[model samples]
Structures are given as C-alpha cells and as structure tokens.
Target chain A: MKNAKLRLETCLSPAMYSKHANDDNIVVVVDILRATSTICTALHNGVKRIIPVSTVEEAKAKKDEGYIVASERDGYVLDFADFGNSPFNFTADKVKDKEIVYSTTNGTRCIHMAAHSKAVVVGSFLNLTALANWLIGQDSPVLIFCASWKDRFSLEDTVFAGALAEKLLASGKFETICDAVTASLDLWSLASPDLNGYIQKAAQKGRLAAKGLDDCIEFCHQPDFTSVIPVFADGDLVPVS
Target chain B: MKNAKLRLETCLSPAMYSKHANDDNIVVVVDILRATSTICTALHNGVKRIIPVSTVEEAKAKKDEGYIVASERDGYVLDFADFGNSPFNFTADKVKDKEIVYSTTNGTRCIHMAAHSKAVVVGSFLNLTALANWLIGQDSPVLIFCASWKDRFSLEDTVFAGALAEKLLASGKFETICDAVTASLDLWSLASPDLNGYIQKAAQKGRLAAKGLDDCIEFCHQPDFTSVIPVFADGDLVPVS
Candidate 1:
C-alpha cells in the first residue's frame, strides 16, 4: 500500500464533516444511487456541463436561465423535472451540449459539505478506476465521502469506498485510516469479480428493487460504464480541467 | 452466526433510537482508550459500586456524599480528582468496598445516551466473553455503543466493537443488521487472537505510549482477564443482574 493517509468517512451528511473539517485533502463525494452515477454518465456521454446545486430552488433558478433542470427526491424523479437519476437519461443524444443544473437528496448535499476541500471529485462505480488513478497521482490525503442514506451508514456507499480503497491499495499507497475503511475493503474482497451482481443483491439495492426501481439499480451497478471524473470547482461539478 | 438480527447503528450511537426507542436489548458502551477499561478494572479488583454520571457536576454531587470521585478530561486525570483514566489506579487495595462516582470524557456520556436501553453493559477487552455471554442470554437485540473519541469515530472503540461482534457471531444467532456492524466484525477478524499485539502497535496506543501511558495500554488489551460483566442499571454499574 502507498500509505497516502486517506480518511474514508462513511456518509455525506453534514454531521460527518461537521467534526473533521479538513480542507487540505482531495474529497471524492460518492452518491452511487444515483446522483454521482448519473453525473458521471452525463459527463461521459458529452453533457456540456453539470451545475451541482445544493437545493432544488437553486436548480430551479438555473432552469429559468435555460439550463436543463434535473432534480430527484428520495431516489424518484420529481414530476416537474426534465430528468431523474437514471443513467440511461444521460445518453449521448439527450445531453450532447446541455448544461444540467442538478440536485438530489444526498449526493449534491455532500458536494456542498465537501466544497471547501482542496479538490472535490465525484465518484461512482462508473468512474471508480479513473478516480482512484487520479487520487494516486496526487500526494495529498484523499477522503472518500460516501453519500449515505439519509445521513446514516449505507452499504452501497461503503462498498464503493472499499472498491476505491482496493484500487488504491493495489497501487501500494493509502493506508487504512479507520476500521470502517478496512471493513469496507473486506466486504469488497468478499464480492464476486462481477461487481454489478454483488451490488444488485445488496440491501440498499433490494430496497430499491422492492420499490420497483430495478432499472435504476442496474444502471447504478454498471462498473466503469463512464470515464468522466466530475471535479467540483467554484461550487459546480464540471469535467476535470 | 447467532442470527440475532444485530443492528450496527444501534451499537455505534444511542441517537438512532431517538424516535422509536426500544429498551429491550443489552447496550454495550465501549470507550477502549480508558473509561471502560478503568471501570472494568475498578469493578474487577473490588470497587463496591461505580456510579457513572454524565456531567462533572453530577460527579461532584456524588463526591459530596463521600464517594470517591474519579474524573478525566482530555484523556487524563483532572486536577483535584481522586484518579484519572488509568486501570492501574483501580487495584483492589485502592477501590475495594468504595463507592465511586465516575465521570470521563466520552464513556459516561455514552452511558447516559443509552439510558433508555433495557440494559446497559460496560464492555472492554478485559471482560469480552462475559459481556458476550450475558448478551446471548438476553432475548433482545444487542446494541454495541462504541463511545468514540468525542463522538467521532475512533479506532480503539471500533476495534472493541468489532471484538464484540466477533463474539456475537460465534454464538450463532446474531445477524448483521447494518454496514457498521458488519464492518466492525470484519475489523475484529483482522485484529483479534493477538489483540494485545495489535493494540500495542496501534496508532492510538503508540500516541498513548509516547505520553508514558504504556501501562494503560497493556491493561486495556488484557482480553477476558476479568470475567465480570458490569451492567448499568439504576444509575450504577454492578455485576450483571
């Protein structure tokens, strides 16, 4: 391991960073189901830009200026929005030159929480390898901020964090800072090589399935399906410059 | 293995039960750095009873009644207090038959947080098996409240929580409820069997040793050295009732 001294906090809630409050490291905010996944998909599919706002009002305000408004609440697309959290919505044709002002329940809120970090990158399974490679390229400490479900620990986020950690570990950097990170890696180790199969069977995925959002689950589990690394700069998540 | 349906959130913090609190299972509060270790040593050696109070004022009130006052601040014994957080201070000669009013930085606060729990048990490496067996006897869910460092995740507390999860898993009814518990159990698997060796070289233990607290480190790592399971009931921690 590279011993990069990373801090992997398990949630995107304000409560997680309210105590640590470090602005020196790279903060990769992950909301795997499905804001981050959607963002990576949009950017990867040639979306002009993504304006990640903290609230629906801000997104709506941007909408009046001709930006496509994408908002989701509780994992469902709001009736008035042009798009929801599905990756399929971000195909090349739909968002080729569009600017998306987006807001979601947990992921966007995490971007706000980590806005002050030295570098903020959006991460999901779709951009896992790219995010890890970028993190390893930097000497600064990395923090994997999991946008947990409603401020509590969620399996999917931690699993993504573990996958990230596993990749970083493969590069021989990034010491395990906390037991949670080590535990996450352990879970990831138990997972089959087919990452999508494992996530589709996860507790969070099961809950989504029960709610009849199996398509969203499949979309969220697609690994390396996108190559975009959404970096937050000046309060907006744009393509890494 | 027990399939007891153990929930990790219930174990990490008592705040989870704020809305629908259930005082059914045993709540194990762990502050492995010193508080719980000190209490375990105190009760094991011969302290008649230790009353864990939430605030210094409450501790002082108990002290006014002629009880021995033990208080800690910033991981050290407070000035004008009878003792700090060292387990060595809890020898049979010092605390035997004495009423102790105990207050520490984090452990007591956790005890108070878990006041609504059906039963609160103080757990540490010193009495891991005793605590686990008592929890197995109970019909309710076991909430292992890791009294983290100032309410943030601390490595020591998580390791202790992991140890508890490992023990529970061995009994064959404890079903992992949340990611946190599963993570803790995974950590336990990596660190146990030679827990003392693990702790002796842990980052926190190394820091403590630098401060000339190696004795406390050794004391805290003594697994199953004391068979006493201290149960918190009626505001006092006594042998499990």
Candidate 2:
C-alpha cells in the first residue's frame, strides 16, 4: 500500500549512517560496485544463506569452520578464499545451496552498520526494481545507505542510490526532504542515459579497472538482473521467503 | 603558474571534514544558508575582525565581555544576541571598525574545524569568483568544506561548492578525481541556471522560511557580491591584506 507519509532518505556513506539510522525505517544497504551485487546474485543463484562479516580475519575464521568463503579487499581475491566479490563467482554450480561467508573493503561493513534497523536489505542495480517494489509494499520509511568507498563518497554507490530513490519516488508512496536524496535523484537522472559510460568516471571503477577485475562493472549495473531480495536475518542474508 | 597536479575536493559536511583534511591544503569553509555568507558580508562592510565561538554559552560570554556578538540557533536570534546571522545585519554603519563575536548553528564550528589547515578561508556565492581566483594562485590542493546542517548534507552548501569548484576547474589549474567534486560540479551545472528555484528545495530553506527569516536567501546566492576573502588568522576572520 502506498504511504505518502513515509520518507525516503539517502545516506551518502556508511560513516554517516548513525545520523540517519532509525529503528523503524527500512535501511537499504547498497555497494553497487560489487559486494551487494554479489550478494544478490549469490542468493538468486540458489545460495542458501551468506554470512557477512566486517573483517577479513573474521571471514578467514568462518572459512576454517568449513564454511565456503568469498573474500575480497581492494578488489583482489584473498589468497585463502574460494572466490572474490564477483557475481560470476557465485554461479549455481559453485554456490548452489552453499552457505558463503563474505567480506569486502566497504560493503559488508555497511550491512552490519544498518543491522539495528527494522529490516536491512541488500540493494544493487541488479535488484533495483525488485527492491523498490518490496520497499513500497512495506509500511516503514526507507533509508538508502550507500556503502561508500572507505567512508568517502563513491560515485557508483551514489548513482545506484539515485536509481533506487528514483524508483521509490516514482511510486508516489515516498517523499524526501533530504539534500542527499535530492542530489542522488539528480545524479540518477544525469547518469541513467549512459550508465556504463557514466560509471567509467567513478573512482572505484578505475580502482577495479586497474586491477583488471572490473569485468563485473557492467554486470553490476544491469537493472533487474535478479528479483531476489537479500534480507539480513539472524546474521545471514537469505532471500525473502 | 597553473599546476595540473593540484587536486580539488569537496567535504560535504564538517562531520566528514577530517577524512578530507590535509595540513597542506586550503580549506574553504562554506555555510551558504547564512553563517559564512554573513561572515563575508561582515568583513566586507569594514567590521574590524569577527571572532567565532562554537557554543551559545561562549557567545554569551563574549557578549558579557563587551564584544559585539551575533548569535543564532536554528534560524532564530538568541535572546542575548545583538544580531542574528543575516548578512544584512552587518551594514557599514553598525559593524564598521568594530570587532564582533559570532556564533551560528553550523558555520562557526566548521571554521574552527578547519583551523589546522594551511589556510582556512570563507566561501559563499557572495565571494565565489574572488575566492576561486585566490585559490588558483595558491600552490596547495583545495578542500571545499561545507558546514552542513548539524552534520547532515545541505543542498545550499554543496551547490555553492559546485559553483566555486566550477570556477576553480575552469581556471585549468585544478583537477579532481573525487566523486564529491564531480557530483558538486554536476549539481552546480544544474543549479546555476536557476539558483533561487534550485535552493527552494533545501530543507534549511524550509526551516528559515517558517521563521520568516528567508528574505536573505536570494541575497546569499548573489555571486561575487563582495571580494573580501575572510581568512582565519590567529582566531579571527580578517580580509586578505
């Protein structure tokens, strides 16, 4: 049901999340460069549940416990991990019904930061429309939390935020008085015409491109690639039932 | 001489200032709704120097000491203040040749936050062009610091940062890879065409409007209204000699 009273706001970085956090608001954690995208893809491809930890050491500990782990830091696959943060790494053959532990430089930290919200759901361009629809169905206000690059703004996450905010606003169910939301909506309007080209200017895109691991950049921005909504429940991300 | 190597960045809020702060950079403190704008107008109107205090209690103490004090909190003049933060209150007859103590809800604190930078200067649409020109002549990288509303994003400050950054970048002496800069520049591009209309959406505007104190909103965005760059030196804002 549409609720005109529900506010939509965007937190530009995870570091700023505390100011925007509300126990009743649904927080949408976004790390469109790869982490959230990978989570969405992993769940869609039949992964049972994923444990997201903040530190690489925690991920290693989870791995030693016999859990399949996917770890990355600064865009590189950890030597002890089974996979990096690429959505491709979570294909059905490798991840089907497996419980994977995931960690990244920025994304996973945000999911944990927003753990206190009414519901913390993972968002990526791949699940943009689906997440928006899910949010519209809920009664809570929506806070789009960008897992920015190490507490600094990341163009890709913000652009994806703008994309999702645009969808939410279009539903006529949400409104915003936040400058961050207004700015993101404008950024989305500007970047949506040529997303691949637009993302080329992102600092993260350059970071991943320099590492030769940006093959997933295009895939990450592919809207509606999956309809799965990864919700954090009891320390694991499982698709909504 | 122009240095292509010099990078320009925008810190969207004073809360996020430390992440972008550098001992070698020039930090331009901006609070476009009124505080910084009032500072520029105060200095330009021949106020000897303005001492900025962070708290209302500090401002009251300064007032008790016989210093002319301008104090505001949440868009209203404090009961003990001789003046509010409106730029119009600093006319030559009233503030000329007198040292005034100032405190505001957001901007003064930001001025203090960037005090450790190589240089901390005030920027507003009022001094946009002159501030950009002066920054181009400096050898250090630039950080545009926005005194956002209580550590949240403010559309007015980011838009002004964009306006200042646009001029700096146009000089060809500055370049930026930071997403905040790119986002600001894009916002400036969009907001430049209709600034008053653009700023109408700011949450701060609504706050000021509700109090009937929004008359200065148009005056605040009038570009290059004065060229008096208020640089912080030895605890006071004085014009560049």
What tens digits encode model 1's per-residue C-alpha lDDT throughout B70-122? 88665667665788668888879889988888887578777877788787889
Tell me, by lDDT, which candidate is best. 2
Off by over 4 Å in 2: A1-4, B1-4
> In model 1, which runs have C-alpha deviations exceeding 4 angstroms?
A1-14, A53-67, A136-139, A165-201, A214-224, B1-10, B13-25, B54-65, B166-176
TM-score of each: 0.84, 0.97
User: lDDT score, residue A182, model 2?
Assistant: 93
TM-score for chain B of all predictions = 0.87, 0.96
DockQ of 2: 0.74
For candidate 2, write residues B97-118 as lDDT tens digits: 9999989767777877888889
lDDT of 2 at A55: 91
Model 2 chain A: weakest 10-residue lDDT segment is A1-10
- i-RMS for every candidate (Å) is 3.8, 1.0
lDDT of each: 0.73, 0.89
lDDT of 2 at B213: 94
